[model samples]
Target: MNFLIADSFTSALARLTGQEQKQTKTAAFDLQLNPAQPGLQMHRLTNSRDPNFWSVRVNQDIRIIVHKTEASFMLAYVDHHDKAYSWADRRRIEAHPRTGAIQIVEVHERIEDTGPLFANLTVEPDAAPAQPASPPIFADLSEDALLDIGTPSDWISDILTWSEERYFQMSDRLPAEVAEALLEYAATGRLRSPELVPANPLEHPDTLRRVQTVATEDELRMALDFPWDKWSVFLHPSQREVVDADFSGPARVTGTAGTGKTIVALHRAARAVREDADARVLLTSFSRPLANALRAKLAILLADDPAKLGRVSIASFEDAASELFQLMTGRRPTFAPDDALQAAVERAIADLGYTDLAPRFVMAEWRQIVDAWNLVDLTSYAGVPRIGRRNRLGSKQREALWPVFEAMRAALAARGLVTRAQLFASVEAEFKAREEKPFTHVIVDEAQDLGVAELGMIGALASGPNALFFAGDLGQRIFQLPFSWLALGVDVRGRSSSLRINYRTSRQIREAADQLLPQKVRDVDGVEDDRTGAQSVFEGPPPTIIECADKADETRKVADYLRSAVEAGISPAEIGVFARSNDYLSRSRAAVAAAGLEGRQLTERAEDFGNCVSIGTMHLAKGLEFKAVVVMACDDEALPLQSRVDEATDEDELKEVFETERHLFYVACTRARDRLHISGVQPVSDFVADMALK
Candidate 1:
């Protein structure tokens, strides 16, 4: 007899029943018939909690208890455990009548349950029912009797509550050991001492001891009286709030570049580990550099404490997922999207009936089909009408087309036709399976560059309410793709708190940068232009609008800027020149070399530099801040505005691209902490004239 593989269940079900069911109902797929194999164990899953819902293993000795009812099958409600059923357990089982005919079997001895396994064991009839309808064991006990019970000293309930409230703004429900310890402390009016508390609270301790005392008005003054020290760095109110709040939901912190987002995130992790002890906290970043930066920062912050270091895991998101995927699947995942497979899908769509649609349009059309296969609501596409004819596809047509597209996508995805979206989804599923609980609070930096699919993946990591924090600048988006946080499902239209005070740049520099994009400037809180009695040394002949003859002249002018800036007080490393195209960077690098001035072109594989002139394309400069920046070589084709174009193409698309470029330029200008130099040839990008001295 052949053993059934869990991977092939969906296709097998579709073949057997002649009906294509969605894979979202995984519980249903697990419960259906077992491909008619003889001598199979048919291990009926018994309820450790609810006895009515049962599951059986095919050709294996695994068992699971059904919890939820699906269209084709039941969902596993409880893991297999040795605990006997109680009164509450029986009611849950009796609530849902078992629908399909499944074989039932009884096993007396409990198997050696090892690893992080969930089981539902069968209870003997003679031995009590899996769950009994008995009164509470302590129901008859009087308040006096409860009070008289011997309790341990060192009750840290108040401390636990205080600590949780400080950071997460919530309370932690005490476990049995902690509750008992708290009870004893309450009766004794004194803690048993910090040493008596369990070493591992995340695994064993039910309560936490809040040792950090809140500073009163007088105490705060007294603390502030001391001379500045390293501890002074840890005393900011914002940092205090992060350290105190008991994060129960996602939180987003939007601040300027130096406003301490990373610092707050690092402190939050440390606080979580020090306070909870038993809980595991993961600090992850999108890039390896950021992750390594965070790890190094955290190491310095958490130095001299061995226990605190053990509880925190710092890694990049890709690294974490890649490791887990390798461990569980026995292979590393190749995350490249299958363009050839997508092409095949496009061809299939055209051959099947879609005549006028391109491959990308066909892919969009098939989105509905994929949604149906995933068991998502078909009505989600109510406003999006079907392709072909103005009659508009009805709900019925959507339902009809869903299975075909979903099947195709799934088959392609399995064969590696996965997109970034599919890759994120798989990683989320893997993370959920591996992690016991969602993070308390997740803080993300550079969130403005995140795509919609990436945002969805971030949402998945935050399990409880209020667990997300994001900080980003819309003006800094340089990606060819839109970084519309709103499009990624973030609401930015509402009245959100803003940080406006520019502290990093001088008022003269800020004023000059603002002049470069007059219309886009908006008021921000705390931003002030405080340049009293000081001349603007940074101010120059209003951005040199040089008229270069061709690309060769453009490169020569850029090389000139690099040499001039270096001759001044600015170090070679302090100066960065940006362009709109990579070809320009390549050509500019050669020109700089010919000019006999040291220059390096930035690339993904480039290493860090201490003091070398840097050249890069605009897109590579997002999320980076520099001391001084030189933007060069803007022209008609590179920075076209709507008024320059004569064709009747999509005006909305043009406007969107224009606005993004404007913001990108704004971001580039703002990167300069002290000085900004911009130069472009004649017929300069229309944006330059729009805000320049006319």
Candidate 2:
């Protein structure tokens, strides 16, 4: 049986066993060989009392025993430790009862310290003579073994440890084959790759048998025909491998813009639901628009199996949470009270003598009333009158006014004077009554924009085997608070993966836009496409940076570009004019209209081709795509608002907003499918001026 020790351990063991090593002292103890075997008895020895005596069990039930004496330490024995050696030393037993048995072996001794002992025992010394360090030979091995040294079994064990230690580094270096194999090993502790695992034999017995018959690599390659040219939803080869991993634990994906993250997520959802018709798979997105889009795509993907469709639920985080809250509370939740409630509350506060305070002040005072009474039932204050509007009311005044409002609300509900405010109050009352009951899962999209309170509300919906699948581009936060999904009670880092390929953009378009965008981004894999051809920013024209004297010149340049793009075979329906502010968009729209070009304002939900030309503020254009994008009024002041760089605000938030703008511009450029035209008036935004088209 071979005992494989690492080079260091082997060196340590060698040193400890050496006679010349002063520290190599043997310790005497009862050496019971084969304790479980019949006729075996413990034999004690007292000739030496050295703690350096070493015994290690290795593969195939073999144990190596070592001990030191005055002149030389012994490589005492190598045998199955489970067998009987002899009787006690006091019993006059034969040292070697078996005539042909060899009890001891000798080897050269090394140094005598703890360091050498540890090194000898744990590591194997390099067999090669002193020479310059050579590159590892396994570097060019098959993708399967490129990541780890040793045989397949050792590779598997190495990966498990590697994943635990340098997970991030390993994850970055993970080859496609390794990822595929790891997934298989995770699901079944065997060294089988996912591709080698037979598909459901019951469904494809003949195909499985045929695949099994293919023995050699050449035969296997010849027998199987893989479609490499087909369009796939995976963002990267690693993502594709993970999807095929079939492991039990949650998986994570992370990626830059246009990396097909949504596509991979949708595919994972579909595959999960398909694998088990009874499994309840929930698909969630941060935004309603993305949710709706995924739902539509999934509906088409799973149309063949009606039962499977029912098992998959695609919903926005809020909608899903609201549904769960309703299920637990036995009633729907009212959204936070709108302007009408504020107005009503102000009126009551005014009647109570204080009119200087805003509705926010009245709401704060109302909160105090609820807290004081310990009244979880907010519905009781549905029609309540406020004490004062804005003035500093004493505790006594607040106390006196509480009963009046409570009584008024009770009286109103009894008389059917309940308004939307009353209905919303009832919902709040219901929510408070059953706040403990959580939902099964609450998935969020655009989580980077979610606030802590919003996340808490969503978290409250988790009651059962709950899991959150939040997808967000931190670089695209247009909202106020940057929500951290990790902080929101989710193991984001563990389940996270990335889609880095810009599937939506052509190579040239991606390159050009990347150069123009000021954020650091890694290149994407598999972004090239042959059918639609490469996307060049120059296909239509060089980004027109017109020197506009003022707003009028800006409008003229936009109008002229709009007409020229159309005349140059670019469809008007494909063109979009984006501005940093809404005012600029409106001006551009009027200017285009006066030039006899039909223009429409673009919105998040607006359908494509609704207008001959579209105009929009940058914020409004997020998540929307357009072919030919013209960025107008690219002035320094408007491009990067001072608030964007404010130290008080989160840097990540600013970066996200900045990246989103860049990605949005990239998205806009890619929308053309064949041509991308970008235009800006000078002095162009810093970002536009730095643009380089490939």
Candidate 3:
């Protein structure tokens, strides 16, 4: 008989107490080894809707529910003895007739409460005049069309009676494919036909995600050790194409927040290494902390095979460039401090007799244009398109500025120091001079944050037909300015795709955060990415937004939120608290302290956060998620980052400060999987206000 594990088992297992979970896993492992073991004390369930349902003793009170057939033994659910039996009584495993996918359908006939199921939604009858009732969401769909999306046979009447808002409240009861399909059709006016039935019903696309055939002890062990059912190995149907497709040239996958871009990147890297035994893959991102998280998840994804993990190297873009530079030159690259660079710029301006240029303009021009592009001579500086600069420079000004930049570069070199731009340039040059590439594949996460010099090095590192792939959301482009990837020789024009189904965040949280960005975001290369018609698989309560009178009140409110989240069963380690910057971290820290829970500050190098509520700046919250999140200190000046706006020399620079700042807040807000709380001093940030008004 084939032994299988259902997603429901893992989800139920996660909620058990530690001691109970330990005992349950032991029982499960033994059952997998020998389902007929006499010591398991298996019993046939008398009340179950599915005759195959049976109970295996986990402990005196806890029970492991299993479904047994002549050819298959599947772990189905687990809980206290009575609750476990109750769950089995209300559910039955069967292949969906239309989609040919296996689903555990709820036995609604056994449910006693039909009043809640048919509750009518209402408007405020006391204050406002009576409004016309909106039409039911699925009233127009024929029964055949309803069955085509995998809706259970008995739930057709319940669905057709649901209005738009009412459907959202009860959508989770339907099968995932049904809810997703109906949601997509309602939101975008696009309907997908039912999947074709495969010969092996288990091979159906939906079955592949919901149910798995465990062929070995190791696979079951890994499955049990994973965090939750949501993190199952199966990719969403949309992500499967991007992960498996072969790109003729450089490729990219873009999406909004929580759309599983990083997951696709990791799978693509693993796929490359698996397809070729000699492949050397480097999975990378823009920051150290995010890279560490990726490495940990990659280890779990590839834990079944040590050799596959050995073929992949993980690093941040900075670390990768630095390692290459040191390897080629036999010495570590030394970087000039920002203060020293500023001093050099000051001296250069004085020496070049240019007194009119503002320091902001001079610095931005040198960093974004000269150093970033490796402009070595006056001609290159003269021809560079300063795309984002609002203040255009004349020929005379360009000539005058080039000499100052030259003097500053010479001064930095005299001190045996280099800028990040210089280090990557040297690495790029070394990569070009070599006949053999360092890695066969380069997969970049958070690719939107990559800088010019980093891209230059990456362009050289990933030159093969399938060598380069980028994964990121344009809305999450917080670090880098927009640039032309085609001009840099990494063209994704024909090979780009955007993911629309979000797996990480809740529908409520996603919609709130989406308000902070434009509906359509275009890149400098004229690649337009639409944020429209995005959908989340699950629903959550609307984010809690509040305004406080003072720092003390803000701290109290945030502390209350933390306690409430904990009381609601969200563990401390699964919670995160963030502020705009380190300057405001003390307030969040105090709130965590007041809540009587440990708080670990996330630094650039933080990896193991232990069992503490994570506290950090919003910037460090990238690529990290939690069950609950608290974003505080959103006082007007703290959020748009007053210092940046104050430093902006032109309208363009000022606009950039707001855009990126909003993106930063959006990133922090969407990091919560289920719950989010935003509190600030009186006069909250404009971004917070946008969430409510928009």
Candidate 4:
């Protein structure tokens, strides 16, 4: 017989103590090996609503609930003996009458006793809002229509009596697809078309998210090992379809943060290697920490298949370019350091007798336009878009400025130095000249940050059909300025898509963070990342927004918030403190010290701080999550980092600085999972005011 594990089993496992979890896992593994093992002491629950329910003894107080039948043996739940038995007695698993998808339902007879799945979703008695009777959000739907969406028959009346808030309150009791479907219908007044019932309910796309067959002892062991990381095995149908797709050419998936874009990239890489025995895949990102995080997750995803893992490689975009450059060209590329480049531009201006132009403007133009696009001559320089340069330059003025960039280029070459763009250009040339490429497929996670030359190299490297894939959010584009991907021959026009459901962040947090950007962001290529109509499946408290008199007052408030989080049972390591920049991190460090807790300051690398609360700048908070987050020191000078504003020479440059700064702040605030505390000095930043936290 086949064995399966339900999402309920993982939820129950998370509640047990460390020792209890260990013992329960051991019992679970043994049962998988031999379900009829006499040593497990399995007993059938005679009084269960589903007669197939059984209980296995884990210890004196713990019991494992199992669903047994002629064809399948499934682990359903685990808890203390009494609670485990009661759970089995109150729930039933069956195929939906209309959709034929499997669903685990809370029997209607026990509705009054059912508690909130997430503790934070439950409001205090004094804070509870009055719930007056209101019409149902789905009042127009009939019983058959509701059942077609996979709602259990017994819950129809209760669902019909629910208002929008009431539906959100009781959503956890419904299956994942049904909840998401109803949410969409309520928001946009659109319902998906119904499909005919399937012959085997277990094979339904939605059913796979709740239950899956374990093919072997090893597979079961892997599934139980990372109960919290079920995304590695049980994918949402939307994500599964993307992973298993074979695009005609390059494709891209864009979404807001926490919508599982990274997860899609990781799985797509695994799928590439698994499908083609001779294929090699490169999974890359623009940020080092994000690349490291992807490597770690890819390992957990492909742990059961080492051969497939071996076929895939993970590296940052710049690092991969350096490696490929060295492999083709005889030596490693030496990049022009920032200080040296600044000195070169200053000297170039002095030598050319052009004292009117600011050195900062010269540097920005050279980096973003001239060098980035490899404008070696005056003709190419005159034709470049200069996309964000609001103060347009005339052809006569461009001709006069061409000599300055030319001189800077000569000085860099004299010092045996190459810009990052030059190195990528060399690699792209080598790849384009050869018929064969290093990797058959290239999947980029943070593709929004790729530079012009970097995209060209990736396009050349991924030369085959269905070879290039990208996943990123346009709103999260902080590191790189806007550039047209289509202009570089990496078009995602027809194949582009967006994920609209978030499973990580709470609804309150998602909504608040989204205030930093518009609901829809369009790229230069005319593609849109529309964040409209998306919703989080869970709810959380309004963030604690605090503004104080001075830096000391801000530190004290953040320290007290930290203490409260710890007292409320959040681990110290599960909390994080962020600032606008590293120079301002001392305030966060002082707060952690005042709270009497240790903090691990994050570096560019992915390192474990070992039970210490994380302290870092908002930029370093990317690709990370915490149970609670404290964004401290959001004062006027510290936020827009007055230095960046003072350095801006033109309106376009100033606009870029402000947009990136806000994006960085948004990234930090959404890192929180449950709670958020944003504090600032008395004369606070405007971004804090935009949060409108209650």
Report lDDT (CA) for all predictions.
0.45, 0.44, 0.87, 0.86
Tens digits of per-residue lDDT, candidate 3, 128-223, equal 676888789778888889888888888887888788787778777777788888888788777777777898877888887777788888888888
Pairing residues by index, what is the TM-score of model 3? Answer: 0.94
Q: Write candidate 4's Cα lDDT for 40-78 as tens digits.
A: 999999989999999999999999999998988899999
Error of 1 at 94 (Å): 77
Clashing pairs in 3: none
Q: Lowest summed-lDDT stretch of 10 residues in model 3?
A: 227-236
Winning candidate number (TM-score): 3
Q: Give me the runs in candidate 4 sitting further than 4 Å from their true place.
A: 36-41, 110-133, 194-201, 215-217, 228-232
Instruction: Say which candidate scores most in lDDT.
Output: 3
Error of 2 at 502 (Å): 1.8
Q: How far is candidate 2 from the true structure (C-alpha RMSD, Å)?
A: 25.0
lDDT assessment of candidate 1: 0.45
Shift in Å, residue 347, candidate 4: 2.2
What residue runs in model 2 are displaced by over 4 Å at the alpha carbon?
Answer: 1-236, 245-251, 325-447, 457-467, 515-547, 567-569, 591-600, 603-611, 636-694
lDDT of 4: 0.86
Please report the TM-score between candidate 1 and the true structure.
0.52
Ranking by TM-score: 3, 4, 1, 2
